[model samples]
Structures are given as structure tokens and as C-alpha cells.
Target: MRRTTDRTAPPTPPPRADIDQRTAERLPVTLPVTYTIHDPAGPIEGTTVTSNLSGTGVGFRIQQPVAPASPCRLRLTLPQRTDPLHFTGRVAWCRKIPHDSPQTFEVQVGLALSTPADVREEPSFATYCHFVASELVKRYLG
Candidate 1:
């Protein structure tokens, strides 16, 4: 059997909410982060790796879809830090990767972290953010 493609087929239009919008600069780094989804009934916990990191939010992948505006607790494990950095964040958006097969697609979640009472006081968190931002600048702009 032979399959033929239509040369005149139109390309699929991109989604309206493009994830490329960067309010804050982000670095492409992979870090393991344990997250607990905050639900009224109970909490659902899972492990995932961060796709990118920035001062405001992080993008990570998950096997299942998480609702937008869901509060979550993240414990990020960075190579420079001995102890995982703990923080609270709110789900800003959720999108599934466009794949030919729906079953193989992974859900990407963007979380906007709630500012700590004293960001200056949290040296480790501040250091980690600086590290990521520096790396991003070094790679792209430096």
C-alpha cells in the first residue's frame, strides 16, 4: 500500500497563547522538581523536570493535565544547592504539546511563583534564580 500526500495542504495555524512570550528572561535548564498540586479535597504529588526557569515562573512537563490557577508547592533540586528550594506557585497556564498522536503528547504547565515575604532574605532561592538568568544571558546574549 502506498500513501500519497496533498501538496496543497495548508499548514496548521499556531495557538493564540504562544508560550514563547517572555515577561521575564528564562534559561533553558533541566532541574528535578517535586510538586504537590493543591486541591481542596487533598493534594496530588508528582515528580517532573523543569524545562525552563526564571524569576517569575517555571515551565515543566507532566503526564497528566493540571488545571489553570491550581496552587502548587515545588521543591526544586539544583546542582549548586545542597537542600531543595521550597516555594509556592500558582498555575498560570497549561498546554499539551502538538503531536500527531494525542496519547503520546505531554502536558506542559507554567507556574507563577508567589513572591516570598522577604525575597532578599532567601539567599538560596535568589542565588538559584541568578544562576539561571546568568546562564541564559551567557548562552543567548553573551
Candidate 2:
């Protein structure tokens, strides 16, 4: 009698290229942030927390859906600086977050900044971004 063997191939890997499309790296952070949506008539302001931060953008959760491409202003205090950093950006995208509760349906918004312009306009912003990226890299990637 001849011996028989069964062989199984390994599973396919995830698509890393699609995931790494972002030009700037993102750091997972939970920090309190206040945001203002610019409107033609008047500006609407609200308080929320940042989910992540990068040189080019930020992510946050909100109670309501924000229209894509809407202009926004963000304010948050980083550990390196005593004063808060202000950023001007636009709503890149928004998606509904599923929850167990019926009364609450939170939305996650991706806010992307108009790079180069912001950093060049504000010297402090450039410094703050550098500090954040360096610190995050040292702590996690170093």
C-alpha cells in the first residue's frame, strides 16, 4: 500500500497597497477637540473628540452627518504646547457607525486639511505637527 498526504494552501494576504494610499501617516489618539463648520450665512461650532491625527488630516465622531467638502476649523491642545493648535480643513467623508443603542446613531467624519498652505501660514502649526509625528514615531515605531 502507498502512503497518501493532504496539502492545504495558505490564505491570501490583505491588500496593503490600498490601505497605504495616504501620503501622511496617521497616529491613533484620543483627545478632546472643538470644531466649527463654516457656513455661508454663519458658522456652526460643536465640541467633540479626535480619534486620530496627522499632518494632513484628523478623524472624529459626531452625532450628526456632515456633508462632504464642507469647510471646517478644528481646535485641539497637544502635549508639546500649552496653547491649542488650530487647523482649517474640509470634510473628506462621513460614515454611519453602527451601535447597539436605538436612540443614538453616531457618524464618523474624516476631516482633511489643505496641506502646505496651513503649515506655511502658521509657523506654530508646523512645529506642532512635527512634534506630534516625531513623538508618535518614537513611542510606537522606534
Candidate 3:
């Protein structure tokens, strides 16, 4: 008896060129962060790791569910920064993962800085650069 061999082509995936063009520039730092989730009833606080941050928004992973398109006040504390950053943010999107997963949901929040121009003064970046410069100076001179 001869067995038949079937050769079938696999399905092609959708083109990602449009997605690449529309995607925003993502910063390359994973800053430790603590965020507070503000709701109508009250505020719920949680700890999240900032996957990436830009002048206008940040992406983080949280356990609790946050409604998309809802506005919230966030008190974000970054590592090595003296003062916590506070701002008003809106939930741009939320996605739930599997139940057994450590990260229950991924939330992308868009924050409105107190002043749009104030982003240049983001303490985290400024402080980090200052520290690095200081360290380099010490290493070279000492």
C-alpha cells in the first residue's frame, strides 16, 4: 500500500507596513514605577513596571482591570527620582491576558502633563544623565 503525501501552503499573515508607520516612538528604558488608579468611587493604588515612556504617554502592566477611554489621575514614582510625578491621564487601551499569567492586563495610558512644554524637565531623564556624567567624571579623575 502506498501512502499519499499532501502538500498544502500555509496561510499568509497580514502586512504590518501600516502598523509600523502608525506606531509611536518607544523609549528604551524600563523605569520602576508605582501608579495610583483613580476612580469615581475612590482611588486604587498599584505597582507597575513602566515598559516604555514618552513625553505624552506611558505603557504599563497592571493586575486590575481599568476601563478604556476613562480619565484618571496618576501619581507615578520613578526610581532614583526625588519627587513623584503627578498628572492626569486617560486610559487609551487595556488588554487582559490569561488567568495564570503574572501580568493580568496591559494598560496604555496617555498623560496630559501640567504644561505640554514641561516634558523637557522630566526628572527621571535629567537625573539619570546627571548621575552618569558625575560617575564618568569620578572614574576619569580618581
Candidate 4:
């Protein structure tokens, strides 16, 4: 029995939206999301529900496909917060697939937190991340 390692070869990357690539655990927290994607043609505005939340990003479905790395503005309201948290980040990924019917299509987009990451230490987002960490602890330990 023997094993070999390809040191020079790059490691395989997980597919887009794959859970394995997430550095933090995702909370099945569905929050209200209002997004404005600045597409090249024009700005697309829509309201959709968040599918999941993580320390690094948020996932939601959009009516139109957002190009990867395209800048976008996201307004999300966390639990017990009346004023929504505003985030500006490039679209991490977008997956277009058929939904409800074959004739209809929806795009699921992942938006990374870029602005708040460098602004004011991102207190609001940090708080949410803390909450997620605690919930994960409760699920796995408590």
C-alpha cells in the first residue's frame, strides 16, 4: 500500500454555493432581504427572502442573474432589529436554475460582506455572527 501527493497541483475547489467552502457554519435564518444589483445594463431592484446567513455572507434568490463580482447593495433586517443592516459587496456567486416550473427560472445569489468588513469593525454583523456561533454551540454541545 502506498500513497502519493501532487504538491505542485492545485487543490480542487468546491463547486459554487457548496457548503464545504463556507468558513463559518450557516444558520437556517430566513430574513427579509431587499437587493439592488447594479447590472451593466441598468440597476435591478427586487425584494426577496434570505435563504441562509453566515458570518461571511448571505444567500438569497433573485429574479435576475447577477454577474459574479458585480457590486450590489443589500439591506437585511436581523431579528429584533427594526432598522435593517446595509451591506455593499460584490456578488460572490449566482446560480440560475428552473424553479416552480421548467418555463420559469430563478437565480440564487451569494453576497459577501465587503463593506462592513472594513468599516467601524462591523459591530452589527459581528453581533449576528456571535449569535450564530452561540446557536451552533447549542445545537452541537447544549
Candidate 5:
């Protein structure tokens, strides 16, 4: 008779505590973003589409690797707005998705807007989401 070893132990998963600290509020709209890395010697510019935006930050995809801790200046054009909005941000984390995929990168950036007063005063959260949704549909669909 062959002896079989007990294999009832559950698999241990990697820690995800960092994910809790980095929770972000998602905006309903997709904004067009042009970002430039601020290097003292010179600046490197790149253009990408923002997946979503929030009062605290924005999320986007990069074609290449960007230094995680580097600061960048972002010029975002909202769907409804005619002028581009300018904001500064620090790259919180940059990681390549799909393990072997080299054509795309996911970046989580923390924005530092010029001032707190710059954000519009909306009466409620639903109103804000509605406004953003409307703009996104108008620009993307219309």
C-alpha cells in the first residue's frame, strides 16, 4: 500500500495591507491628460489617457516605466471644460500589468492641485457624479 501525506493546509496569501492605505475614490469621467516628468536637468513629456480622476489624485496608464517617487506636472482637459487644467503630482507607484506585458504600465499618482479652492462646490456626491458622467458621455459618445 502507498502512503499518502496529509495535504489539508490552506495556502498562505501575500500581505495586502498596503492596498488599504492607498484606497482611492473613483470619478465617473475619463479626462485627457498630458504629463511631464519634472527632472532638474530637463523635463520628459508623455501623453496618456486618464482612467478616472478624484480630488486627491488621478489614475492613468503609461507606455513606459516612470520612477515611482518622481514628481510630475499634469495638464488635464475635462470633457466639458474648454481649457486644460494644470496640476502637480507625485508618482506613488508604477507597476507593469500582465506580468510579461511590456507595452503598458499602470500608474497610481497622487495629485497636488494648486489650491483647495480650485475644486467646484457641489451640493451632493450624486450631483458631482452626475456632472462627471454627463461630461464623459458628451465627450466620449457625442
Candidate 6:
């Protein structure tokens, strides 16, 4: 008889939300989200909506679990903006919920603001950041 062991990792401890570690406040802003993730299983792509938005990061729901620290591409459609913003971001976090689709159920993903797009994308992501920052300054100062 042979013994088998599954490659399981220790679960990451949940963050202390009470601490309010966020640098920028997240707003309940819903925008369009089309994301693509490349994993060992394959490439996963889906159209979803953002759960929240912030200057430093974005929270959106997708169909698959995107590995943390992986580079994921996203196209965000801002309201009243005719052009969709395309950018690549590092997967900051994700949480999955049990759904009808086996273990690969719905998962919410968080993406950190990464570097400007160099290829296969545009630089609108950085522009969006600037727009948000300016808005904040205006609201508080102006």
C-alpha cells in the first residue's frame, strides 16, 4: 500500500478590518469589468462588475479564482467615457463563495494598481488613477 499526500498550503489569516489599514477609502462604485487570468489550469476570462472602487485598488467579482500575485489584465469601462480603460494589474487578493458550479464557483478579486502598460494594452489605467486623485483633492480643497 502506498500513502498519498495532497499539496495543501496553510490558510492565510484574515486581515483585521477594524484596523482600517486601507490608505485610500473604497467607494461603492460599480463599473464594468472584463478580466483575463492565466493559470496552470488554463486561461479564464469573464465579464463582471466591480463591487467597489478605490484609487489604489479595485474589487470585482469573476468566475474563477485568480492566483494572488499573478498578473491579470482588465478592461474597465468608466461611465460617460467612450473608451474603455485597459491595464494589467497584480492580483492582490480573492475570496470564493460556494455556488452551483462545482469547486470553481464565483470569486471576488482584488487588483492592485500596477505599472503602466508597456505592451498589449493601453495607459488609461494610470490616467484613471490621476483622475481619482484630482477629484479627491478638489472635493476636499476646492
Candidate number with greatest TM-score: 4
lDDT per residue as tens, model 4, 107-127:
777777774535448876666
- Please, what are the lDDT tens digits per residue for candidate 5 over residues 1-142? 1312122223447658767654344565566789987644456687877776665567676654555446788877765566676666666545454335666444444343333442455223333445556655666687
Per-candidate TM equals 0.72, 0.73, 0.51, 0.74, 0.54, 0.67
| lDDT tens readout by residue for model 1, 37-115 | 7745567689989998888888898766666677999988887667888888887777676569756877777788887
Candidate 6 local distance difference test against the native:
0.71
User: What lDDT tens digits, residue by residue, belong to model 3 across residues 1-142?
Assistant: 1212122124447668756543334454466666666644466577666776654566676765565545666655656666866666666555554456665534344333233345457654454344434544565665
Q: On lDDT, who's better, 5 or 6?
A: 6
lDDT, residue 2, candidate 1: 29
The runs of at least 3 residues in candidate 1 whose Cα sits more than 4 Å from the true structure, single-residue gaps closed, are: 1-22, 39-42, 98-100, 140-142
Better of 4 and 6 by TM-score: 4
TM-score, prediction 3:
0.51
lDDT of 6 by residue, 1-142 (tens): 1212122234667779789654576667788988887655677888888888787778887766666776778888887887888867777777776688675667777787665445225358566876666656666777
Query: How many pairs of residues collide in each model?
Result: 0, 0, 0, 0, 0, 0
Give the clashing residue pairs of candidate 4, or none: none
lDDT of each: 0.75, 0.72, 0.53, 0.73, 0.57, 0.71
Candidates 3 and 6 compared: the better one by lDDT is: 6
When 5 and 6 are scored with TM-score, the better candidate is 6
In model 3, the clashing pairs are: none
TM-score between candidate 6 and the true structure = 0.67
